[model samples]
Target chain A: MTGTASRPTLEAVAARAGVSRATASRVVNGGDGVREPLVERVRRAVEELGYVPNQAARSLVTRRHDAVAVVIAEPETRVFADPFFALQLRGISKELTAHDSQLVLLLTEGRDDHVRVGRYLAGGHVDGALVFSLHLDDPLPGLIHGAGVPTVFGGRPGWGDGPRDAVPTVYVDCDNRGGARDAVRHLVGLGRTRIAHITGPLDQTSAADRLDGFRDVMVDVDPALIAEGDFTPAGGERAMRELLERRPDVDAVFAANDLSAAGALRVLRERGRRVPDDVAVIGFDDMLPVAEQTDPPLTTVRQDIEEIGRLMARLLLRRLDRAADEGPVGAPSSVVLPTTLVRRASA
Target chain B: MTGTASRPTLEAVAARAGVSRATASRVVNGGDGVREPLVERVRRAVEELGYVPNQAARSLVTRRHDAVAVVIAEPETRVFADPFFALQLRGISKELTAHDSQLVLLLTEGRDDHVRVGRYLAGGHVDGALVFSLHLDDPLPGLIHGAGVPTVFGGRPGWGDGPRDAVPTVYVDCDNRGGARDAVRHLVGLGRTRIAHITGPLDQTSAADRLDGFRDVMVDVDPALIAEGDFTPAGGERAMRELLERRPDVDAVFAANDLSAAGALRVLRERGRRVPDDVAVIGFDDMLPVAEQTDPPLTTVRQDIEEIGRLMARLLLRRLDRAADEGPVGAPSSVVLPTTLVRRASA
Candidate 1:
């Protein structure tokens, strides 16, 4: 390594390597699509010259910072403790660490923070972003799209049918519809007719897809059997109480997530309704801590959240790696991981 | 305003503003000291020229990245879901957003990851760092110090008396000792003489200080009354079980954190020990979900974790802002926030 005062420049390295500046820049960025011999020559030249690419200067040339911004845009503080993001973050961290990339975590406060996020992305602060935009009217999608940074969303984004809709983006998500279908199918198999559903915030695609899945299975079902929850224990409790008030004979319940199911379970216990006896209950997102620790233990749909995080990172990295080559990189398609039924004491 | 292709350079802006390039740079990089009129002129020239100082190029001159690396070196996944880091991150995010800076999060896995972290920092990717070095044997402090990046630690780092021990670094910590004292005092006020303690992992300073605080209150205490936990629910369960087996007549318990207290409460309930009636319980960190949702609400020591995060960001930002002027930003002093006792039903 050369001393900072006399650090070698990319031009000098390129000259020494007997290569064009463009080729050297490509090699430094990632060496994708470059011939192995030329890549090695450039690499040796860089080492020999002791050239350290200044992050800012490097960005100016290659437009790559080797950093991905993880934008967690949740308005509700209760969800912060839900362990979903934690598992996903761990997965993302491991994958990014392996790639020698940095994670710039941006926890947005509200609508105002969305503007800040958009500006930061547009300003080229990071190479790509992994965003968790859970709401339909979030406005972040359009903003992020306008910024033109390659992004892989954590969950499927909700887009309106308006003319000014956001461009389709790549995302990694669990099969929420299929997961809900399995949960409801399990309840149906238990010979429960008056099945009630507790949905997470419908503004999110996951909740909306789950609701759709429920509707698909229970065609001609009574609307009163559904109650909205914000995916928190307290919300689940409120929704369960509302459902109980509306349908006294409800024999099965499918809460969107384990946290909501935990809340619903507490309510059922308080009302003296025996789980799986009076009403078989199933929850989605078999979050281990909540699913395992609930009083009777919850029978739920389990999604590999950490795997989703890893896949998101992998997709973004691949896209970024391809961008270094002298060709148009095709837009990446979304990835949807399968969910499994986790049977426990609740059902 | 200038467009991206023809974005103005700092030198051009300096000429337009009739100031030296250094003065123009100072203005661009958070203009800390230069007179008001010159600052205004430089800013106007920047606006007129549509100047966006290349982040890496700016760093080359100012030696400031306008970014801070937040190093969280916890190997456990449970702590990630504890909402402690979430609250602290929110605080740090708000402060950094206000200052127009970026937060590059570094989550270390093990020894190999530590080497990667050291290399990245030494490579000068960020202006400074906010490290949470929980373990006593963490080799990060020495490696980070060697990297020459100005660092402000989140918790007091534990160091052994070796020849290469790191210099006393700036840190922000809650008064763990004082909080523990308050917890013990609350138990003592309830006339609990046969009080037992569940200590957090002793590798962390918070755990050690809290244990020290317990000793300060309970002189000549029975060694068998204390059991060690890793600040996890499972760890708490194991420790509580061990404590109960040792001191069958224990009338009170002080868990180092709310999660541990929740675990201890579970054990007490399973063992048919009525909380606050048979055995009063107190916990630290006052994490709302755990503290408030326990069978009986937990009495806890409340430290403002978010405030600690905000203060850490503010201190590091202040140091970076001062580093612009050619002067020794003398050693920064540490900050210790006070904790309060929240008396809930369990106590």
Candidate 2:
């Protein structure tokens, strides 16, 4: 009470309310069994003194920071390149808000950030983590596992044959392979034979899964029909150009995502190929606005991105609760939500 | 040491290292002024026991959370619509990470979140807050200000005739009015007399400022020459259509931002109008990929959005340091960074 003249301490509030420090503490921390009159007096005293409870101190006894960290391994530009992460973040935020937990967002751009993130998680600053480890060779999954924090991954991580692989990971991901299969089948239903594919960066599991789906359908297709893209409009444009040059007779194209699809559409327009008439096109991840705003719109695979985010948070929160209620029980199983093909003007 | 059987306490580490609890505490909490051999022994013991420091306990004595909350007033979708906020976040992350501060991101989508954010900020969970109160009528500014936590804003808030206006708010904003002026003046230099302006939602200060900038150059033009937008591509398309119907002779358009500009371009293209010959277009906030991806590319007013974020962090950290050294000095003044015109094929 006497430490900082301008700031009121718990002692001051207790003295003003004519109660013991213990009674004041109970009253301030929710007043479970405190008498109503005493609680009211303490509340009034707190209001008059403008007392703010120190969260860190309360968290020490409760062993709950009430905060969850969402670790995005990509740089900010990549995170914002499309609306995928944004929608996911919103879903995660909504759920965390419902649970009365704060979201500690960690965006790791490079190797240095990896060390920082690993250290932060191991330091026990947050209760649990929702990590987006998109890349197959990403070191984050291994580092995070080593940190020994309860975590739920955003996408299905590529678990290599290491000691880390033995640790079961709870993750929330869309059915990328199935979605790609649905897209390719739709193009096949359109009576298009010479179909080409533009894939997102192979390092990412989503892109790799999509590629596998494409191959599952086009088992004997020419290898020249495939082009590598980085899930950006620029990459889409380059890939589209290469595909057109390699097989000018190609009647349809399947792009990994909407941004690249938009770029491919632009190339088709430049080359005077009518959409769905001369060259039908389909894309994955209907990252709206881009999917909707592209000239003639886009026919693509749609994943409930927000739901994935929410599920990730729910899984992590459940794990945290399980850990708290009965030490650590068996980990929750991972989730794989379905994806549906959205028909539009393009395909 | 004996509270939780599985979790190792600081006492366990001290006992394992054969040192006094005080000596072990000194070593574990940085090893300042501790003997090198003793520090090594304590570190080895900590590693062997997997002892993680109790952050809450340490924070109670140090009075530092080593964390900052980034309060984004917008919902996740809008934040992700363009890369504007993403770049700003990256800039902030870069600076905060450099200073060893964790980022606690709080995304407020509705009214309930306002209360949650206010409570979290006032609870002394984090050292400070960087808030983005984009809308003029937003209640967030008032609630956050009432919390009495140190805060810095992302844009100029619409502070009406309230007692809140008396409190000087520190913020970081690009020169919206000035950037708009440059955009319109660029059109004027191109000899376009029938130039129309697409205003962003007037509820936002950035949009309002840009409209003022248009008026600053256009002077007394037809009121029909201006169209309202919500900074989305759909909004832009709607506004562009409205403008084309209102003034068919319009030869140029200056959209408040790039998404809107892209929409306007789409509309113009659909109407079979040749760009730059029949109509030229310009946009603000060259939000990278969008500005670059637009057909004919876009001439734009470029503001260092990332730098704005970095500068905001720098200002808040400076204030925090000043407050720590002496009681609060004069508040740091708000900053308005200059914007420059970027010429592309569109204009």
Candidate 3:
């Protein structure tokens, strides 16, 4: 036990218990069919010998590794920078652990790795997959479906119609539209009419929904102020600069994400504008670092990313367990978790 | 293909390939010594019939999944909030992908998941594991090694001598001592005589080494100016406030990590102290958001977390391949990557 000596195997336990290897494995793995007397004998042997069943051997019988793949479509740098991914990862890790599953993180940004990921999933290396950060018309969803494996996308895939090809998918989306609208409404409530918008990449559904929410509210008020950004601080800075050059008197801004808002804050500072007093800045996706560390701590929309991860894992696990017996376990359901407006110093 | 369809088994592929099931499995898995003509026939049959071999079946023959687990010991909030984890994850993901290995992320903070993780690794669920954030006397490194698994720790495991067990570990650390010394020396060169040190958690090797480095430099300058923090923003703020109360004449501060430095900055600002002009601040482990978003930005020591991850993965892969030929790999080895002083508005 203290040195590099290998632990006793199932065969040794079986030999000690005077039972067959199959009976020993059955008792160790807690299979239901073993007799009560044999179970006790095997259990005592396992305790005495301190035998841990080889996981590889068990996986061979079960044909299930009890692992799930979490695929992200962003560069490693951006993924780490965004607190949203971490929160979701934590949530997923927690839920997966409850189900005795492991989370395999797959970054599919590079073209070569992306193809390899498709083949890996298709090859049945994982029990299921939970994909995040899907771009519109992304090939992964279809590729996964074509491979006959169960998958649940984090956000709604670009496929407009419900579950394409009968591939069961569970989309856990934040109330991007409502959250963005609420953010803009808060600005309007503050009596700022010349409000501009800094949006994320238009290709992403989150970006589109948020931008649409901003436009929907703005059209009812005034549609003259609109600027697009790529959901980055630099993008926000450039967008804010453009918005200012277009309308110097713009009194408020709604950035689709926190980094962009931080960028807008930088641009505002450079232009000698006071936050909240001169320009009320609001960002979505209440990312932790930017939300708290912003000059005037950013007032933003808080999306419960951890909850999203938990829900996605639960849904995928359900599908993995009952896909054969009960067909798809849940409805091709879309769960939109609520987003609340966290009013901080900036807004 | 449209509805839920059971995946084709090896038996199905064997029937389709006009060969025995064992022969088909060997051909599909690229087993050596197979005749070329039959191999060509098997390959064509696999492609034509859209047959994908289950990884479990393939693993039985090849005993390789080409996957490794990278375990982080922090909670989800901390994992995401700290840019260091993200950078390292990205680096490991990139390197593993290059080696055609999958990266599995295992978070061991949740106590309930501990058993599942232990079983997963011990069961040969992964080829090897790379673990991060080990406190002194932490049981995980020993437990993993005890299970006859190959593992690597992200940083020094706080047991000053090195890993106590014969587990072959590759530790990727930053120049904590040099970075801390340089930060203190920079403050000294700035003509700030009364410099106070804010240290990170004493248990972590980085924190301990940094504290040692700071003390060494301070002894050369003045050993009287020293305090301790937990590498957290609140901790830094508390430490800074205590230092201020203890010595109001303290002109400069050196924080062990960036979060604590950010905390220090907040406290200094609340007390109406101007950065650099009044009390200059320096931080280590230059995490992106905190450093960038802090007012006037932060001057800190930059550790390449991505490189650390990449190196760790490469080392683990090498260890895994080497162990395949030899018995278990030998004692743990450490790799200390270089860190640079990033000058910004803080110091």
Instruction: For each candidate, give its TM-score against the true structure.
Output: 0.74, 0.72, 0.75
lDDT values, one for every candidate? 0.79, 0.81, 0.77
DockQ of each: 0.12, 0.16, 0.22
**DockQ preference between candidates 1 and 3, better one:** 3
Per-residue accuracy of model 2 over A1-347 as CA lDDT, tens digit each: 11122445789989999999999999877669899999999977866665656665667687777878888877755776657788898899889988978777766555445645655665556788898846775556545654567888887877732224345667889999999999999999999999999999999888999999999899999999999998889999999999999999999999999989999999999999999899999998888778999887999999988899999999989888888888867778888999999999999
lDDT by residue (A203-239, candidate 1, tens digit) is: 8889999999999899999999999998889999999
Poorest 10 consecutive residues by lDDT, candidate 2 chain A: A1-10
Residue pairs with colliding backbones in model 2 are none
Top candidate on TM-score is: 3
True contacts kept of 2: 0.16
TM-score of model 2, chain A? 0.89
The candidate scoring highest on lDDT is 2
TM-score for chain B of each model, two decimals:
0.83, 0.89, 0.84
Report the number of the highest-DockQ candidate: 3
